[model samples]
Target: MADIAQEAGFRKNQKLKDALLQHKALSRQGFSERLFGLLFSGLVYPQIWEDPEVDMIAMELSDQHSIVTIGSGGCNMLAYLSRSPKKIDVVDLNPHHVALNRLKLAAFRHLPGHGDVVRHFGMDGIRTNSKSYDAFIAPNLDAATRAYWDKRSIAGRRRIEVFDRNIYKTGLLGRFIGAGHLIARLHGIDLTQMAEAKSLREQRQFFDARIAPLFDRPLIRWITSRKSSLFGLGIPPQQYDELASLASDGSIAPVLRQRLEKLACHFPLRDNYFAWQAFARRYPKPEEGTLPTYLKAENYRAIRDNAERVTVHHASFTELLAQKAAGSVDRYVLLDAQDWMNDEQLNDVWSEITRTAAPGARVIFRTAAEKSVLDGRLSPALLDQWSYLEERSSELNLEDRSAIYGGFHIYVKKA
Candidate 1:
């Protein structure tokens, strides 16, 4: 087995390494944290929660720009490639994520056509995925990544076999979503039916009649109270604490309810694949106009041609930024990773960010709280070197179709 530590990408930085260990140790507290840790240690997000379309608009990428981003499920990074940036360096602490990203990159490059790509990733119930993997994706993967997917489980099937079944229903987040469907079923709410709603009015009505009622259930409230239940959402304990602090009465259920409302009712169900995945556990059928930019038929060729521009790294953002020469990077996508950082870790990360950012460098990230974390956490001197695009950030935050995060922020390095 690949050493989880090395794959975690923390060993390069002593501070980050220490922070990771501390979180792991603290996760031993009780059944909740332990279970959360176990879930987090594996693939947490089957797809990224943050909207890459919002990110692409916010980043304003060009061939002159070099971008670095956190690779969660590798979806957004692949989506970002559609913009044809100079290069995209995708960093992730999870080896599974790293492997997943590499697999996606290879799939885009080696898959025969857009239909095949769609078949491999977009739809489920395909019996040819394993054969497709062996024929196309496997040869392109590095040995470590290949071994990770090739490893057999107790069921006597290689882990990659999941793609043949339903990749969307396989990861920690996937199963968590599946469990949610079960709960919805128990309450007589058909989440799949929500996907078929015709309009926002219909969506809201369905949410109110069928889905919203489940939020009031005693079991859901009890489950949401525990930090462990959110592991499937890819929320770490530290992030849970931040979310709880923002929530009234220190209960996360209300916050989750509000977010779910936005996800289900705020956007047209036909166009919002994020909501579809949450409610239905998969993207809309290929016939539906809604799909991630990377998956759309029109962008496939561009993504395939530019797929080589993405390089996956098993490292922290700071570690990757430290390796780049000063002012070499023009765009940075942090996701919600700062929510997991301590002040020291944040400083370390932003320090490298400032050091490597180009003249017009823009950094974009999401947070569990509705405000940017940089204001109170980082040193004023360091923070002052970058200008917060407050109005633009707020506008983009509103434009974020994902509707899961509390805030979207953008900062540009000052001239």
Candidate 2:
């Protein structure tokens, strides 16, 4: 574990090392930019970093063309299908994500039907809802996933037991919130009630009065900005460039605080489901507000049937691009995967994207910083082919529910 942690960029800080060794600290919150990709390749993440809704908005996809995207947790790919795309390809390096995607598909196809499937996945992940899991999902899982469910944790808890235990509450993002929970606890603020706040004004007051000050503390800022700290969040060595681009000097925690503050203060807690998922561990009830369309029970069949357009690949974006015809894909969604690539890898990806694009083919992606990845990365020849929809991207960005990514850029493939 020490080697694993250090390989992920954890410096040999005695306090952190001791904590990590004892299982008391589980995050690599402030790891440096260079070490992230190596650390995260297949070890920790079950999902990708960018939000899928944002990708769909930026891509402006149509059913006329095929869609290619990183699978991540496979959430957004399914979310994309909700738009009626002709086809969708979901690719990832992680087997865990592949397995999870299959699980979602199985539930969609076999569960006691749509509403039950929605309740199982999109609900609060609690509330004693064992009907769908037992009646349909558990019996339909593939052999490997079934075996995974059969295993037990070190504490002797069955893997499937996570449904009741709320695995939804402990993903990469979930763990980040858990860290914030610990930090908030240290400051004597019980954030769970922030969800009950009625208006943005009250929300702002809470952030200004309670959360903002946490960033001002020297110890907290120093610890959080360090490269060694972010590992606990499960960001791999390759993806650090995306995170570093979020701030000018490459500080992470301050931006994190700002985003969480925005999530809590920019919208009423009752209407913000992402905030509810993070802080309150529940979805907003229908009487309170709305959820993502994919979260609704009615969308299950479309999601399950659309699995044909969705293909999961154990490959990189560039590798898949090689198979696509020139100007073939009408829309492409690269979910910040380029940030994990070195110079050579990035060039290969963009060159292929440029080659395969049709006159109206649109390529969309999010980066860690406010600027586009093509700025200093792609060559002039390759970059000049597409029309940059900066203004349009920004307009669509306002509607994106996934508030995590930095900037959305859409490029129309040159005719």
Candidate 3:
């Protein structure tokens, strides 16, 4: 919104780095489920990685290239297959994310047809998607998963009803908007479109003139500036550093507000599919929407086309790399995963990458800082064999939807 929030006056701040260092040094760092508790405690899930729609437009993917990604919430994998990659191999250490990925694949492969599929997932405007749980998905899940889905909420509503009541509740970005809406209501701002406004220009103007100013408030800004406040958006320990670095003087709230406002306020409500998922909690009607990648009617056929290229293992990144042939992978989407690793661990990941990267292999990753986390920590010889495109890196970052990642980087293996 404001020249990409990287204006000259904004100094790259390191307080988040200082804060993370202390957090990392603590005993039993990142081990407790309590940390993840912040992620799912509310009725909603946090979001990272903007929607894949815009970024996928840039890839110009072919039938030949294979993809490997972390299966965070599984939205993007289905989105990628919409373009028909040869294979999409998603890996995640978190069982919840893996289960969700599996569920999405299972739904696509097995769900009866587009309208029913859309109604099952796209209902409740996405905010009330839990209703579809009772109607469609819950019955389909195995006993354990069904039990989890059928669990009751404190409000006494079955979690399954959340589909009808909360399609917008699925991921982090939606929750952030919900939180923002709550905060806005507390301040007497009505963000709903039906309340007023006749034209799109009036809508954006209203946001610019009335709604956006609240971000300048001391309390809201202060609360959002802290590193912990962002865990709700699934800003794992690794991405916070880069997110904090985005602001001048380490004030991240303004930048976050700008990008998020873009997600919320910039486009028409119905046409904005991400917002449908985030705000209304439903997929647009067939004429009103283009469903996310995994939800498409064509996905089963698309993913099934290249299914053979992938191999799934119940393992971590390092463990899985150990089993792969050298120089075999082409694209790697490590979504905020390296933050879990310290120096030694990162080196081991890099060693595997160096050994496994084919000539001209492109490795892309998002991080919490503008600087490469692997730079100083990696062996000089290993780092020297690659090309880093700083300017091109900036371009690739342009239309990313999740509005959460701070830095986008790409490294190419030399021939």
Candidate 4:
């Protein structure tokens, strides 16, 4: 009965379909969109790729602020709880993401200690995690969320059992990383060597010696040139075009190579868990490297105490903001979702954002290209209401540990 209910929920995700399907079904672009929609309809990000540390600084988050943000993988929202925000309305088109967000909130509230929280989310492939879920976390979840996790996956194990053996290895992004590892292995390169580098110099040497050559390989260039190859990264056709246009040769290989180079060389591996995930496929052990803000031991007590402030909504960010009163929200974290929007969609979301923004409210988002996506697409009136912090955005974009996005933008609502 739970499985039936879950299947119904997955099939009925009209909002997701509406967001992804812009072209006719028979066209190649349309087919790729549908395929991405299908893959994204399930769990796409086991952990979101954006840097929450940068987001916090961009928003100037405070206890008095009310925030509305897209909830991808739920990590950043939980991290925001550390700030003791007055409210966090987390909206997502994906029901699985909604469930995952709710589950994390419940875990923070119910799980006994910081170690237990780390065990559940930070570590990968622990057989005891399901036991902990059944005993501690499951009972605290809402009925729908509980049913969603209780439902079995295609592997004949309950969805909750993913924690029993590397939950991070189960999602679309996880499989994408795994595929990348396999490809590297086939070419006689060990991707994990990047994680072992002790300094920036070592990191750069490893990238030049081992990783840079992989991008120039004929097979790799061909695979990356296809739009479908990036579905695992949650990049849509429009964003893929933007990414390819950045390279002089108009191939995604050089763009991807540059991004991976930043990921490998810009920060010490000992401090970047994002690097750990990219190269090691798992977060570094506690004394080895850093974890996301939400998973850090020091933030656990605050996150647990403030977990109730977060409310996960299974809907679009625009729809959710439209329902709020004017001047109600103080902060907005859009992630890289704006890269997926068409002109109308961009205008619609920004309209609501401008309408609902409080005095001096801030909005932050990322783009696949090295400029704000809203430059000309949003109506002039709406665009004029916000001040783009271009210099600060560029500075922080470099500081972003994830290093996946081409640009990070900050817009402050004109008072």
Candidate 5:
């Protein structure tokens, strides 16, 4: 059996070593936690849940900024590249994510133009994707990344074949979204209808009539009640508990219902690729104007030109920050990784963050719960060094098209 560190990508960080080991041990105490851990170790998220549009606004990223971020799906990393940051150092515990990030970077660098890259990633059933990979992307990939995609699956097809097939349906989140469609089908509800909604009223009516009813289906209730079942949504046991705690009846379904409603009704389908993926299981049509910020036709040149600025690593955020000189990094995007940590782990990461953050540096993150965990968790002195942009965070969270997270946070280093 693989050790927790090996599977989870723990290394050389004194602060995270024992803490992660203990967390792993606790995860092993229950079957659900262990199963979710395994799922997490694999490809969990095909795309990030946080909204990069809100992130961009909150960070005010520019050519002068250097960013350090957790690379989940590498979507936001590419999104940040559009601003032409000095550099983006991406770290993730999953080796699979590291490879995916590397592959995306290579594609951006070597693909002939914007349309090729968009069709390769944004659409399914493109026969030329594999050919494009062989001709352009494969040669540029690192040894490990190349080997990962080269390995064949049980279907006797290389995993890289997913690009030609449907890359969105290939990861844990993709599979989870696919499962939701299957469940909806069993109940005689076609979620794809939600995508056809012309207005917010129509979206809500569709949800109330079709998608919303599925939540009450006995099968859905049973599956959702089991903590193991949500791994595909990238909700670890800890986050599941946080979400459940927020529900009055201690059921996650209600919280999820509200979020799904926001996803379907709060934004137009033409501009929300997240909804396109959830309901239609693919990004919006290229002409639909709803692609991710990085995938936009106008921004493609900037993204391709700035591809070399990113560096991917399979390491902990704290470990990478410790290696950097003090006051070097200008932006930090932690996603929801901090919710998986205890207070000690939180303090340790914040210590490195404070140490490495340049003057006027900004940090952004999201939480599974409505409030920031750092409020009562970190020491007064450490917390005092930064100012929490509560009003701004709330405002931006409203604009976050992803609509999945409970809160979005922004903290700026004090002058």
Candidate 6:
């Protein structure tokens, strides 16, 4: 049976709305924000965009660390589990994300093995996943999380049925990628061809011949101009502004093209699962390519064993940190979420982070632009307590396989 109180609390999306609604209700920006909140209230990222491998290096994760992070898709949390962290408190404003994290945790704890785990998360269109959920995963889930999956979506199927098809192909990000594929198909270009490239040169040749031309089309530029156009990429109105500013001519097309170039040509397709997701829309077979840290076969047992150390909270990071003891957290992972925050919100989060950070704590985050969002935004008093790793951040930003973010940043608490 569902815990009525827990279910009710999780169902309310007002906290998400409050965080996103920054302008007057009648304003265009306000409408866009609210619309994003609506779409985002459901699933957003099927997989988190930030590179956890880079994160592990930046934070220097060890068995001694206790991490508190914004749980976008729960991939990072589970990936961190492979490090055997002492504890990880995963907080998110979206109830659906909270449910998803809990579901993954339950899967790790109760599923038969790595193969079953992959069947549930890695591959797509496996109808038996619902059965697996019923027999193993569901029984282990909390009342609220169990009720969430059992509930029917608008499609008149249980939310758990997402695994029955392609779980990775169902979220807002998934639908956005699907739309991109549709748009490309209409242009006579199969974006998936990038996945077939045998080498970097081949990848660049395909991008130049097929992909680069589309960005220059009048229709493409026109569509990318609208703020609403990027809602699918999970770029809120504010972050859209930050991203648009990166283009010299104030067109997002060039910026997007540059990012896509990195995804297509910067790394070998066989090793970059992020590239697989962007071009192939699915992870490659085990023999064909790599996977996220948490999904890899070698890390499965460690993740499953450490699964009990994570606690998922459906609340803002700041709110969760407020309830924790001062100096309790050793690491923080904020994944481009600060790009959506106003100055006050930034300061509020930083205040909590500074107050709760343990000695020698490290924080890693990404941004839509090429500099720390904290500069000229967060209070100097709060910001001064941390030393920004500008050089290391620049190197890691280039190394991040996701290729979407403009910058990856790390800040260490002053000893």
What candidate 2 gets wrong by more than 4 Å, as runs, is 1-52, 125-131, 232-253
Writing each residue's lDDT as its tens digit, candidate 5 over 1-415 gives 3345334543433333443343444444355555566566667777887889899999998999999999999999999988999999999878778899999999999989888888888888998898999999999898899999998865688878888888888778998999889988888888888777877788888988888877777788778877777878888777888888887765578888889988988888787888988998888775664788878887888889999999998789988998999999999999998877878889999999999989999999999889998989998989999999999999999888999999999999999
Tell me the tens digit of each residue's lDDT in model 6 across 268-332.
Answer: 99889888988998898877788788999999999999999999998898899999899999999
lDDT of 4 by residue, 86-164 (tens): 9999999988889899999998999889998898899887789889899999988889999989987566789988887
Model 1 residue pairs with clashes: none
Query: Which pairs clash (backbone N, Cα, C closer than 3 Å) in model 6?
Result: 125-165
- Superior candidate under lDDT, 2 versus 6: 6
Native-to-model Cα distance after best TM-score fit, residue 195 in candidate 1, in Å: 1.3
Clashes of each: 0, 26, 41, 1, 0, 1
lDDT of 5: 0.85
Choose the strongest candidate by TM-score.
4
lDDT of 2 by residue, 353-396 (tens): 88877778888887655667778778888888878988987876
Cα miss at 26, model 1 (Å)? 6.8
In order, the Cα lDDT scores of the candidates are: 0.83, 0.65, 0.59, 0.90, 0.85, 0.89
Please name the candidate that would achieve the greatest lDDT relative to the true structure: 4
Determine the backbone clash count of candidate 3: 41
Candidate 1 segments exceeding 4 Å error: 1-35
Question: Lowest-lDDT window of 10 residues in candidate 4?
Answer: 1-10
Which residue pairs clash within candidate 4? Answer: 125-166
Q: CA lDDT of 293 in candidate 1?
A: 76
What are the per-model C-alpha RMSD values against the true structure? Answer: 3.0, 6.3, 8.4, 2.1, 2.9, 3.2
Sort order, TM-score high to low: 4, 6, 5, 1, 2, 3
How many angstroms is residue 306 displaced in model 5 relative to the true structure, after the best TM-score fit?
Answer: 1.1
**Runs with alpha carbons beyond 4 Å of true place in candidate 3:** 1-48, 54-60, 125-167, 170-174, 194-200, 248-250, 264-271, 279-281, 286-289, 296-314, 339-341, 368-372
